[model samples]
Each structure stands twice: as structure tokens, then as C-alpha cells.
Target: MVEKNTTKTYIKEWQKAIQKEISFLKKFGGTRYIVYNGRFISRDEMFTYYFDTSSSLPIPIGSKIRLEWGGLKTNGRVLSSEGKGMIVALEKSIGELISEATLLHDPWELLENLIERLDEIKKSKQKRARLKRLMDPTMEPKHPTTRIKSNVHELTLRSKYNPVTFVWGPPGTGKTYTLARVAANKYLQEKRILVLAHSNQAVDVLLAEISLFLKRKDKFCVGDVLRYGTNSGQSLANHTEITSEQLIESSNPKLSKERTALLVERRTIKQDLTRSFSKRDSDELLEIETKLARLLDKFRQKELELLKKAAIIGTTLAKAASDSAIYEKEFDLIIVDEASMAYVPQAAFAATLGKRVIICGDFKQLPPIAASRDLLVTEWLKEDIFHKTNVADSVNQQKLHPHMLLLKEQRRMHPDISAFTNQYIYKSLVADHEAVYTNRNKIVLQTPFSGHASILLDTSYTGHHSLSEKSSNSRYNLWQLLLSFQLIYESVLGGAKSIGYVTPYRIQSNLMNLLIEELLENENKNADIIAATVHRFQGSERDVMIFDTVDAEPQSRPGMLLVGKDSERLINVAITRTRGKFIHVSNTSFIKKNIFRGKTLRQLVDHQMQHNQQVTTQKIGYWIKNQHSKLAWSHARKQSKVFQDLQSAKNSIVIAIPEGKTLATEWERMLAKRHPKVSFTLVSKQPMQHLQPNQWMDENIAFPFILIDEEILWLGQPLEAVVDVDPPFVAARLHSRKVSEFFIGQLLKE
Candidate 1:
């Protein structure tokens, strides 16, 4: 029997973690908005609230929102987004309170479910033992384990004997593909299975794979698999027949007819209420709302019945936990794909609903994006199942767990590209599948820098300075953005089919998106390209991956991209996402200075340098200039060229520096003395004591750059470099009025 004290400690820890999450949400205003106007729609049987569109975060369609007005609050789920309005299905009618309502974060219903599940575990001996085994990695399984097998799929199939099994999959290891096969096999055995993932996209992807597998085996039926949520991927539209809502409507004509009739009545009543809000109309509206609620309850009952009969069910973790009907239902087996992105509590909650649980994910990838930094919360909530159970430690230490299976063969990246991750991240545990070395997967970009599978574009000569936004913690680097665009543009021209631009910051990703759009517009080329953060790029691969490390400010330490507990994992994901070529765009000088904090990044750079895979700024500039002479050029060795370019400015000059106000003041004086008529504005993050407010703007600029005459854009080496002895600085010049105007607008934004 488990000790009572230990169980109590677990309960307390879970409670503290949940509270910390709630506290953080309250403090940071997690997905909230205040309604300016609201009204009940009888036709749709839902409430519509119009709010300002200037929210810090967008409220997703399926998010549960809490409405508060006049000291009363009610809960509802967002049905859809309509213009500047949100359509929500509230639990109860607020009548006139709708207009004065404030939409708050989702209700803490999941927290209650988690706590209740903990209490149930505390009361049941079987549950306690299962939880103990899942949480305590040292606890040996009561059942004898099967012998290790070379085939990971076969090993996963045999995992039914163990109470819990972990699939330690690294990048490109086909983690979801393996999980789908195991789930399909279990379904064939007549065992009801629950498939869960961290995101709706992941859940849909896995369900689609399982559907295909079952169809290939000739055991698939119309109602064999059911997708439980509404936010399904467009690709899953092919299997719309398997959705719970669709299945219920088709199978049971009586309930479907009733729902249709209720919806029609609701529409009629809503039309009447729109004309008048009299007491009688309000009463009629409330009556219709009651009828619709009863109808929805019936639909839920039917859905539960359908869920019990289905061979497999797929939904996100949040959906599975928040929905009471799904939470009450149990399954014979539960498989969580992308389990590393799920919190420990979420995985544990999934564990309670199944007789056996299998978690498939790479713990070396991203973890749950938690807002709280409380030690207890980070220890209990931020950690995924692998870390919580010490499985990650065992895998890293080369100690194999009896119930854990590791998929070492990866079919995604080329041997040359995978070598770095294999040595530095995985400790040589991962191997390339034979198919990866074939001619089909060879790196063959048509660009000059295409021979090697990997290239580290060292931006040290250009001084890769990054800026943090004043409103948010996101950072952006202009030089990296421009260089990445050139590389991507050249690769697209070289016949690259697919490309993925991965960055560590949202601002930088946004900049990349703009550049890609321009490339498509100007070049009129058709190519598959996606720019996003590393978290969004997980579970995806591409022909050429551009990993932009957008943190290189000299004054500040490396950002979370290179100085967090998960830094190595982030780097590993970024590097391993490439199938043919991997480009690491970073400032080597900044990384070397902060080597202790950014050890993983420094190690990656060192590996590339040792292999002579370093691409210089001069080469990039020369290549771009050769392709489009008027577009861009680099001047690394000559400070005279930068000043010479600056001297050509006739209209205005805006110099933005993060620090060094003294140096900036001297440079501004010299520039103003030289060009007396040109407007000179020195922008810095701190107030300049020597300049007027009009001449100096206090803003949180990340890097130093000079916008000359709103036509010539000078990036690299602050204006201070002109006066002081020039270090190994590289300045880039872009002659694009559109690009210059875009930067000027961003810098001058209120």
C-alpha cells in the first residue's frame, strides 16, 4: 500500500501547481476581454458579445469563457468568431446582464477534475499502485516484462502487459506513426482506445493515420473511430463521417429531428426578440433557451453512447479534461501522442481513465508553455511525464527501462545534417535510416552554398544585435531576417520543394513572414514555405530548415532560446527538422561571450566550425549583390563605406541604439555638424541627457541601425563605430524604399 503521507504530498503539490497556474493567468490576463455590447440570439440559441479587437491574445473558438457583470458571473464556451464579436454558448441566460458583462479567462473546471481524480486515486488501492508506478520511476512493474525487441512497433504492441509504457522517440523518429499502428492493432483486438494529443492538429493527424491503417487492414467501419471535438483540421474533412456530431445525426434520426426542430424554434423566437425586448419577449426567449439546453443534454447523452461503442476516440488533452462527459468515460487503453508538450497533471489525468497508458513523445523537444515560475509549480506542473517519472534521465544516461522503448532510427534528416544532433544532443543514440542516405533524400540546392548539408552563417562580423520589444518579451534581429530571406529566396530558385523557417521569437517569425510574402509577390514563384517558432515546427520536417537564433545583443545575456533548462531540447528540435540541409544563422561572438549560459548553441557552432561548414557574411552579400545588384551588399572591412553611404542621405537620419548614449551623442554631434540640414534623431532605450526630447526618443530598441533619408537602410555596427576605432564590424546596405518605409513605420509606432 502507498503511504498516506506520500499521497497527501502529491495532492498538495498538485493543488499548489494548479493554484499557481490560476494565479499566473489572473496576473497576466490570460485570454480575456470586456464586452462592449452583447445580446441573446434566439435563432442560434447562443449569446453574441462584441468586444474591442485590441486584446493581448486572441481567444480561440473552443475556449471556455467566464462572463462577469453586476457582481454575477456565468460560464460559457466560445462557439465562433464573427467580425469583432464572439458567439458563445452560455450555461444560463444573463438577460440584460449581457451588455454589462466582461469576458474573463476560461473557468477552472479542469482544475476541479484534476483534484477529484487525485481524491479518487487516494481512495482506491489499484489506482494508487498504478499512479505510484507511473510517477515513481524506481518502482519496478509487478508484471514480468517482455524481452527487448529490435522492432519498435512490435515492442509497442507487447506493451499491453505493463501498466504504463513510454516511447522515447527523438526527432524524425516517426513517433506518431508508431503510435497510430499500435492503436490500430489494439482496436483490431476489440479493445476500446482513447487517443489524446496536446493540440487539435496533432490529434487529427494521428486519427487520420489510424483511420488509414484500419482501412488498409479491412476492419474499418463508419463509426469505428470518432473525433470528439469541433476544431478539427481541414485534412480530416475527408473523414467527416467519423465525427461524433455527424455520426449521431446520421445514426439516430429521432434525436436529429428533435434538434433541428428546436433550432428552428430558437431562430423564430430570436427574430421576434430582435424587434422587441419586452418582458413577454424575454420570457419567451428564456423558455426557448431551456428547450435548447435540454436538446443539447440529449445530444451529449447520445455522444456518450456513441463514444462507448466506438473502437477509438481522439481529442486534445484540454478537451478531454474539461468535458465532463468525456472525463467520466473510461477506456481500455489510452495513448497520448506529443506527450512531452503535455503537463504532468494532464498526463496523469489521462492515466486515470485507462487500464493501460502509453505516452509517445520526445522529451528532448519543447515542454508545456507554463507562465508561472513558482518552484513548486515548475517542479510539478511544467515537467512532462518523461521528466516527472525520471525516464528522460535514464534515457540520457543510457540506462534502459524495462517498459520504455526507444526508437533510435530516424528517417527524416540526412546523415550529414543528423550527425550534429546525434553526437551533441542524443549522445550517438540515434541513427539514420538507410532510406535517408538514398539519392532521393540528397541535399541538392542550386545555390553556391549548397554542397554541404549544414552551414553556420556566422553573423559576428556584422554584429548580430537583437532587440526586445517594449510591449512584449519577443526579440528580433534585422540582419538575421535579411540573411535568412536571401538564403530562402536562393534555395527556392535552386529548385527546393519545401522550406521551413524556424526562429526562437515571434517577432522574428513575423518579420520572416513579411519577407516571404514579398518574395512571393515580387518573384511570382510558387513554393511551399512556412515561417514560425520552434514550437509550431514540432512534429514537422522540411527539405531545407533555416534555424534563426534571434538573440545576439551584446549588453543582454542570451534569451530563453539559449539559456533555459530546455535550451538544448529547443536547439535539437530546430536542427533535426531538416531533411536535406540545415542552416544555423547566429552571431558567433555573442554566443562565445555567453558560452557558459549558451553552451548548447556554442557547441553546435563549434561542431560546424570544425567541419569547415561556416558561411561568411561577405559571401552572402556577394551572392545577393550578384543576383540583384541594387538590392543588398555587405561592407565588413571598410568603415568608410558605411559613412560614405550615410553621407548620401539628404532627407533624414534616425539612429537607434540599445545603449551607449554617450557614444551615440558624440556620433550625433559629428553627423549633425557634417550634414547640417539633415534631420538627426538619436533613439535609445534610455533618456539622453544631452539632447532634447524631439531629437532623442526613448524606446526599447534591440540593435543599432541607421535609417538614412528613408531610402538607404544601414544595419550593423552602431553609429558609435564611426567615431571609435572600427572593430571587425560588417555593415549591410539595403536599397529598397519599401523595406526602409516598413522599418521606419515600425520604429515610429506609438
Candidate 2:
């Protein structure tokens, strides 16, 4: 095939030519001299030692000169017009220029290689037809796995193919765990894999997960795994098997030898330059310049060698793109974790380095952040391989190209906690058996008021807003800050293993950090805790979480930056981050009035109320007396429902109403002779004793309305004793057939 001489064909060549210019000028122009007399001179030195009175110079005196020595660049003016040579001033000396020039070799050679590969693919008809075949629906095959979860099995089989495969991972659906296992399985087959992500933290997370899986279950020694990236900090530093950049730099024999020799040479040059200045010898300067050039070339060669030997490499896209050492390298497969959070161009660039690609991420959690609003609307910029390929209603329903597997089983969140996201985002998501039963014991440990698993604190007050003119961080609300501290203290007292404070805005995060620091400084609790902005805590989770909804007022809006885009993603992330408990702090009235009609927090609160286990007890008084809603039991619809529950009782029922409570008088006046077969006992208060086996209640029970019988336990606060005002809070209809038998059994024993 003939190559066209367009920008696409010669872009890399242009880049190389520019880099060569920077290199040649740095070596040729980077020179410093010491005057015979005692004078310190640096930067843009004259071409001649003295001006020639006979020959006129081509350029005028006092002209501005810009000089770049390797990486060291600066501009200055000619200082003086001497007889044959003019003195020029500079900011940096020869030592600094030499140090910077040594690093002038372009590090973006890998990116250039990827661009060239893309150009080749675009220009070649055979490669394009092969890619088209890989994406063809007729060519796609159905392969099964021995693993029980169909999603993991499908992903493993698809990893062998040459086309791009997407694993649509909604929140809590074990994306990292699934991909790590697949990569490990491939490694056992001796296929080289490259794991990538947008951030170092994400890459480290995948590395940690991979190490844990290999050590804990597979029992496979992970000696071949290598982490190659700019980020030196690895969370799994103790696991010596996982090699990091720091380890390679410090331990590689060739790199160590050359770097050590270079350092020694640099020190000797500094000493020689000082001696020459005293002896009035200018020839040492040339010797130092020649030595610097040789040492730099040797250092770069060693760096290239270390990268070529790495079999299975893990790195962020930015590091992989810039590292020149890995330019010519290719992998059998590249697994991109958190692919949805990366810009399309970045993920595409990483894809060019490998033959087969596997992208695992949830577009429902968060999309790539675009700086300009216009870019968000641009069709091509918004596309991620994972999301773009997933066009079918469900993974199983697909009949055509772009193979995908949807991971529907969530194992991270409690059933009660996962219901929100399951409803709003992942309609097909179901909780695994372990996830459903894991939090059962944890629920009993929490006090009733602390929100057994989830709670929503809805306030009507306009929270404090202090906007800084210089930043985009949302202002902190004083009320929300106090509530976060209160919950943190409560969680600590409740024996929470760890706590995390999630705020949508930076200002709230900053304020919450102060409160957490105060708690630590006072030595109040030794609980493990951390507070961070929501964007920073994407790949993390904790035992219990407190999300501070910073936008409290109706007019201020919920999140400043999350207005038009689907804020449901932000909510899903916050809700699914906790395995034990989640508390949402926001203004209820504002959310109801101005937001998505209270669909976010209100839905969670309603879910919690629906899942709360009902405690059966005959005594009730405290709620009627303490709660002051005059029309509490006045809702006609609520009253009708309560009577319907009472009428359904097969045997005797107990009704406890505090004195002067209007609902009790109304019940007495209304239902004295309605049902003769069912016995009715009305009492002002019930004694503090075991009313049934494992059932007890104090005389001042706070619930305004209560009806406990052989079969049902109904407790609620009426809106107006009429039509439903707040359907979720108005009444709770709970009934278990065993409750009636258990009540009779207890009575017979008594």
C-alpha cells in the first residue's frame, strides 16, 4: 500500500524533527565561561573571546538572544560590545544547563508509536477488514465457563478474542474482582497482559486486588507481575512480588551502574570547573560538556532495556503514553479498569498498544469530566468503548457485533442498601446470597435512632453558604457540618469498624476535615476514619458512610457542577459505597420542592422504612404524648386503614392510648360495638413487662397510633385522619402468621 503524505502520515516524523532540533541546540549552544579576572558569568555567552576591530560582525549589538540548553531554556540581552566578542547575560550556569540537557530525550515516544500504529491501521485495507470481521455479529461466538456466575464466565471466554470486549459493571457489581481473575487466568496460560486505568490509585487498587486473589485463593506465586507507572506509591508495597517503578529504579543493575557513574562524573566536573576558574584555564569547560553528552546517552539506553524485559506491565495511560522505553512493546491483551472515567482519546491511545482489549467500568457511576460544556455535547468525545458498544437492552438479548457481558450480581452492598441503585440505575441487578445475609447481624447491633442501615435527615433550614470568589468548591453548610460530626461520633460509639465522610463539594470536605481532626486531637475515639470529596473517593469503600449533601436550600441547587448531567450517578456512588450503614444529610423541604421531586433521598428513606423489622408490643403512650401534630391520627384514609387492620384480627386485640389523646376518645366513641367476636381492651398505658416472648415495651411508647393483635402490629402517625399526606410515614402494615401463634403460645405459658 502506498502511504499518503498527509498530516496523519508525517505527524510523528514532525515531532521527532522538533525533538532533534531541541537536542542539537542544547548541546551546541549550552556553554559557560569564566573570565580571566575574578568575574562570574552565565547564560548566552559570546561566540568570541574578544571583538575583532578589523572584521565587522554580521548581527547588531544589544540584540536579544533566546537559548535552550536541553531542558534548560531562558532569554537574555547582550550585556556589552567588547573589541571582537560581546558578553551575554543568562540566569542559569553550565552545571544546571548540563543537568537539564541530559534529560532532553523525548519521553513521549510511546505515544508517538501509538499514533503511528493508528495511522497504519487506518491506511491499510487488510487491517481495517480484519477489525471489521472482529466486530461482525456473524463472526461472534458463544462460549461458556465452568464458573457459576455467567457474567464472569462470559468475560473470561471473550478475553481470548481479538476484538474489544466490554464488561458493563454497574455499582457494587465486582468489576475489579472479575477482571483481575481473568487476567490471572490468562497469565497462567502465558499470555502477556497489560492492565491500565486513568489514575495511579485505580491501577494500584487493581494490583492489590490481583495480588490478594493470587495469594488467598489461586495460591499462585505472582512473580511475573510488574507495575510500571509514574506513581511510586503502591498500597501493596509489602508484597515484594509486585514490582514498582521505585523498585526497578533502585534494583536494576544496568540502570544503577550508569546513574552512579553519571553522578560521580557530574561531581568531578563541578570540582574541575571551580579549579579552572582559579587557574584561569577555559579548556576544562569543553571537557565537562563532552562528558555530559556521553553520560546522558548511556543513561537513556539502560532505561530502554529495563522496559523491554517486563512481561506483564501495569500502568496509568499517561505514564504509558509518555514512557519512551515501552514504545516498541506490544501486549496480547490490555485490560482497562475504570474505563468510563477516562477520556475517549486516552482509552483509545492505550488500546492501540495491545491486540485485544477488555474495558471494565460502569458508565452509570461517573463519566469522563469535560472542561468545556460544548465538548460534552459532541458525539465522538462522549463515547467510551464500554458504553458505546453496549447498545442492546440487555447483554443476553444481543444478536450482533461488539460483544459485551453485563455483571448483574452485586456483592458489595447490603440488600437494603442496594435496593436504591437497583431501582434507579441497574434494573437487572440482584444481590448475591452472601450480600443479602452478611448485614443481618450488623443491623441488630445498631441503636434504633442511629438508622439501623440507612437514614435520611431532612431539614428545612437554608444552610450556611460561604462562597470563595477564587474556587469552584461549594460552600459549607454549618448545619450539615454539625450533623456529620454527630453521626461520626454516633458511629464510633456504635462500634463501627471504620467510617468515611463523603461530600460532593470541596468546601464541605475541607470543613469536615477540620471536625475530624478535632476529634482525633481530643483523643475521643481510635476509630479508623477519613473524609474526602466524592470525586476523589471513587474506588474506595468503608464500613459506614455519612454523605453531606451540601446543597440545602431550594435556590442553591444540589451540586453546582452536577446540574444538567445525570446526578443519579453521583447518588448511586454515594449510596453503594457503604457495606454496613449509610446516612444521607440534606434539606428535605428543598429536595421535595426544587429537586427531582425528592426522588433521590426520599426513595432511600422509603426503602429503609419498608425494610425495617417491626417489633410487636401491646403498650403505646410516649409517641401520642411527645409528638405534637394535632391532626396526627386525623387522616381519614389512615384512620380507615387502621380500622381495617383491627377488624381483620381473628382474636383479641390491645389498644394503648395516652390520656387526653384525641385519637383514643375518637376510637372509643366510634368502635365500641362494631365487632362483637373480637375483644377490645383500651388502656391509658401498659406496664413495663414482657408482653410476649422476647417482646417488651415501656409505658410511654412514643408512636402516636398502635394496634397489636394475634396477627398484626400496626404503628404509624396519621397525616390528617383522612387521605394520604406522606404515604411512607402515615402507616406501616406488618403481619406474620407466626406472630399470632407465638402470641397465643406466650399467653398459654403465662
Candidate 3:
């Protein structure tokens, strides 16, 4: 007898229904799907039911499930008969299971029963819909599985619109671990599931998940399969790193890039409805795209001259395949993680390879390409020409199919910090679970805090001869400032704090070498100093954050950081890196040296200058954390100290420093010595003139070319601090880097 419950489906039309006679695999290959109310799954409900290594039954797809504390497993449809067939097929024989089986009243039996009932209903509907929509465009997916929530009476509010779902679980939210069963259900049912991640470490974690899931499938471990986008993604491989240029290119060549392009085209058109791409300079880019589209038509028709003439547009979508006729490789699903910092074009370029996609991200963290003055914008042509004039239609943009949804609940930072972030960050979110205010589910990343943080404008120097001189000459006087802060914090703490050094480019990596060598590598000083790209820290757990905006371009604020757009799923990954304590160090001391030339950063710097002019010192307060960076922002401004989050931030702090003189000095020295033999020639072909600060170049400055071994070096003073333009042959123009003694000879004032 079916237990009568109030649970029912809300959006009558189920985009994906469970398949008949097939065991649910991963998101890609589940035999079928079941539709039910999803709104019932609260932010806290998805994890109420827990399946461990010991649970004889793996979490099935489209199953009515729930998890509760204590060993009392309360479930509805315990999957007694159909599950038997799946287990017999994937793991063991039906004979062995029946012979040894003694069905007990396991509390989870209820959940299994409920799932069967739901599956049975789905099966009946499938039988009808399959025949009704034989060639129907609306019923296109062969077998799409609706997301299942383990809490509440139903799992309704699932996302299937773009066929790509994104869940940004911060720190200990089990981001990687939770996908195990979800992935397995899709695979068992039969689907090609691709895991797209930015780093090898993340892929490794997912590999561990696959192993654990298979180990429990006593019967079906044979057909269980998994694959990564890279060699380092293999759980057992020990391969070396591939060059960044090579790694990003030809990655699954036709497959991945095609999928990304499709996603890019769709998302751009969708967003264009609300925001004007022209206002963002993306509209003018269309003029270039139209010319290329016509050229492409000529090229596709075997016109060689068109190819030579279309270099400009091809630069935007290098091999971007917009036509569906060329891209037909269909997949069950594509899962993308860490997407925020991803440039929009790169993400869209990779989506054409997948049939289905899921995206996840947190926008409030750090955005893509470091917060600079203004932002970069790019959009592709909409196959449909009718919507060109009135592209800002909100209805079309909001028409995210039932499955294409956003997740709002944030399980990463502490409530103390999340409040400050959400309040300051996502004023408007796209999903229900995108932001939650509680500490019940997050990891315990609590660090002690007492108001001791303060920014010290240090004035010292410690580096090699050339680097040391540059450090001394820097506008910020960073080395001397760093030493001063180190001395003060060392005296009180007696050891180094958990400090991190972040630079926008590899050139910045040189500066951290000395500090890291003296402490971490040498192990001479008792402290912790980590050097990493800001990209790697996304979705990580950290106590203190110190931003080195010293030479960084200025900016206003960021809305999101898209690192990758898997398939059609927009998974923003970078901006959600820090748990507490954010510090920014920019070369604001001399506004002219600021690398970024945009509206956002100018506003920030100008506002701060205005702020300092109004606020007096005696009323000011301060806080401290690591030995590097300035006095925490909480103490520098009275208005900021009122936040309750700051009350718990004694141990966590934000250090802000506008650029100064000394920091640049040491960096220049380091740059000159790194290429002691490098030489540069004037791009204008003019005789050497006075090398003054403002008159170093004429119009469209260019320089000589040389290599610093295999390492690619980006020069400063004009192209950086928020403006990202790194083309190998072109960078030499304004930002030159050559391995020759000629240029260094002239640059060396000594």
C-alpha cells in the first residue's frame, strides 16, 4: 500500500524522467528520472541523510530520500526489489543476494519504498511521454535525472535549464565528496561524465570519491568508470606539469572547446537582455564579429582570402565554433567547478563539447583578472537576428528552465564573516541556497582575535644588490615596511603568523623568493609564509587575507569571478577563497604608477583619499594579524569597526596599502638582475634620448625581444595593474622583456 503523503510535483512538466529497466548511474547515464517538489529541500536538507562506506545501499537517483541524526535511518522506499536487480547486475548475482538475504525492518526501508513509488510513477509517465514526444523539441533529453535532496519531504527546486548545475560549497561543505553517489548514479545508468576543474588537486579529490563509491558497489564496480580532462587528473598517474600555453590549448581539442563556445554564445545573449554589451564596449565588438561571420561563410565555402582577412574576429574566439552542424558530440553531463575568475570567452569556448552542463561559483570572492579600474567584456553573435535591436528582454533571461537554477546557500565561511560578505557582496542572488546564515553545517575554522592588528608603513631594505636598490626606490618602500612589521609582530608573537604572499603575475613571484626562503624554505625563522596565485585560493579555507595591490591596477568592486564555464554551466570559483581577514596593497602612493586605467579603482582610491581627509587620527582604531601588510582596515576607519563581524575578527584582519615609493625600487632591481645580459632596442627606431619617467616612449611604444630562459615575464609601468594584455609578440611594445646586456646596461644607473 502506498503511504499517502502531502508531497507532490509543482512544475507538472518534468524535464527529465527516470528510465525504465536501467539502474541510475551518474548525472550523465541514469536510466531515467523522477519529478517531485524540490522546494521542500531546505538549505540544510540536502545532507540530512548520510551514506557512508558501510551503507550496503548506495544513494539511488531520483529517490525519495532523507537523512537524520542518530543511527535511526528514516527512509520511505528502501529499494527492496528493483535495487536487488541493480545490485545483482552491478555487484553480485540475484541468487547470492536472495540466498543470504534476511530482510529486516531497517528504518531506511521507508525511504526506499517512497523512492520506488516515485520511480514507478515516473516510469508510467515515461511510457506515455516517450511515445507522445517522438520528435518533439521540448522533450529532447533522452534520460535526464532530476536532482534529489535528502532532506524535507521532496527535492523540487532542481536546476536543469542549461543542463549544467553549479554548487559552490565552501571549505568543509563536502564540495568534492558529495558528488560521489550523484556521479555514480549517472554512470551506472550509463553516461559520459566529465569533471572540469581548474587544478589537479581538485581532480584528485574527486578521484578519491570515485574509488570510495566503487568499493561500496559490491556488485556493479565493473562498469563504473571515470575520466579527467588532463593527465595529472588521473588518480594513479605521476606525470609532470604541461606548459600553461599548451595545457589550455588542444585540451580535448574539438570536444571541450566546442562545448565552451556554445555556452558562451548562450550566456552572452541571455545577459545581454539585462545589461548593454555596448555600454561595456562589447557592442562595438559585434561589428568585428559580423565581419568575421561573413568571412567565415567565405572560408567555409573554400575562400582563402577570407581567412587572411578574418584574423581580428578569430582572435576573440580562436577556433570558436558557433555552428551546430560541426559540433554534434553529445554527453550525459558536464560538471564545472571554480568558474568565477574565468574570462567569459574561455568558458564559453569549452561548452560545445557537452550535451548537458552544470556550473557553480561564488561572486563575492575575488573576480576574474584581479579587480582593476574597468572590466573587460566580450560577447558572441546571436544566431537569431530578430532579438538584436531589443536585446535587453528580462523575460528571456529569467526563463531559466526548471533545471537551470542557481544555488544560494553558502557553506564556506563562518556566519560572522558571511554576513559581512553577503551584506557587502551579493545584494541579489540567483538561487535559494546561495546564502545561508548558520554555523551548523560549515567546518570549524575558528581563529582567535584580539585588537592588535595595525598597518606599519615600514622603511627598510633586504635583497640582492640590484633588487635591494629597487626595493629601496619603490614608491611603497615595501621591504623596509615588511621588515618593520615583521619586527613588531615577531616581538609580540615571537614567531611568524600564517602569512601569504600573492602577486598578479609570475614576476611578483621573484619578490616573495627572499621572504619565503628566509622563513619557509630555509626553516631559519619560525613562521609560515605561503606564495600562490590568487586563483588557487578560491573555495579554500583561510583565517587571514593580505592583498598586495602595491603594483596592482586600481578598481571599484567586482560582481563575480568566473574561472570556468563547464558546458553551459557558469561556475565561478575564485572570489570565494577567504573565510575572514581581507587586505589590499596597491601602489596608490603615486596614482600615475597605478597600472589599471578604469573607473572602479579610481573611485576606491579617490573615496579613500576623501575619507582620510575627513577622519582624524585620535578617533581611529586598528587591528593586526601577519607580519606582512598594513594595520587592519577595521582600526583605520571608525565606520568599519561597527560591524559585528569585525568583533570576531581580532585574529582575522584586512590590511590595505595604497602604493608607495620603496616597494617599486626593489622590484625594478630584481627585474634588471634577472636578465643581466638582456638588451632592448627602441621600437620607434630613434636614437637613445633622456630616459625620464614620463618621456620614456613615443606613440605606441615597442621594445626588443629576448627570453628569460623558458619563463615568460610581463613588464610593468604601463600595461599592468588591472589591464590584462599578454600576447607574446605584442607585449614587447610598451612592456618589454629581453635577455640582453644592452638594455640592462642603460637601465643600471649605478
lDDT of each: 0.73, 0.54, 0.31
User: Which tens-of-lDDT digit does each residue in 1-750 have in candidate 3?
Assistant: 543211123011111121110122221232222211111111122221111111234334234432222233223322211111111111111121111221122222222332333333344443223222211123333233554454110111122233334344333445555555555555655655555544455555565565566567752342233332223444434221121222223333554454456445534542442243222322322333444455435334432222222211001111122222212333455554544444332233234345554443333344443111221111111111111112112224533233223344556544443433343234333222334334322222222123212121211111111121232233222322243233334322533344444433333344444434433343435445555555555545443444443332222222122112220111112223444333333334333343243333333344334433211122222223442222222211222222222232222111111122112343233333332233322222232233112112221222222122212222222222212222221111111122222233323444
Task: Score every model by TM-score.
Answer: 0.80, 0.59, 0.38
TM-score leader:
1
lDDT of 1 by residue, 1-750 (tens): 867336556766887788887777665545557665465654355554333223323566566777777776677776544234345677766774355567787446566666677776677776666676677746455544465444544545545667788888898787767888888878878888999988888898889888888788888898889999764557587777778888888988898998788667656655554454444644554565567677777888888888777889999888887777677777889998889998787887788778889888888888887777899778877778888777877766777676678888988887878888888888888888898787534464445365667889877755535766546768878878878887787777767778889998888898778766654565435568989988888887788889999777544688866777788888888998888888899887778877763378888988899898887765654445234443454554455666776677676878776655345444555474546677777788677655442377777565577788887777764545332223445566766666677677777777
Q: State model 1's lDDT.
A: 0.73
lDDT of 3 at 729: 11
Q: Best candidate per lDDT, number?
A: 1
Model 3 scores a TM of 0.38
The ten-residue window of minimal lDDT in model 2 covers 614-623
State the RMSD for candidate 2.
21.7
Q: How close is candidate 1 to the true structure, as a TM-score?
A: 0.80
Off by over 4 Å in 2: 1-139, 142-151, 212-223, 231-234, 244-306, 376-378, 381-383, 390-402, 443-451, 461-473, 522-525, 554-563, 598-602, 605-750
Greater TM-score among 1 and 2 belongs to: 1
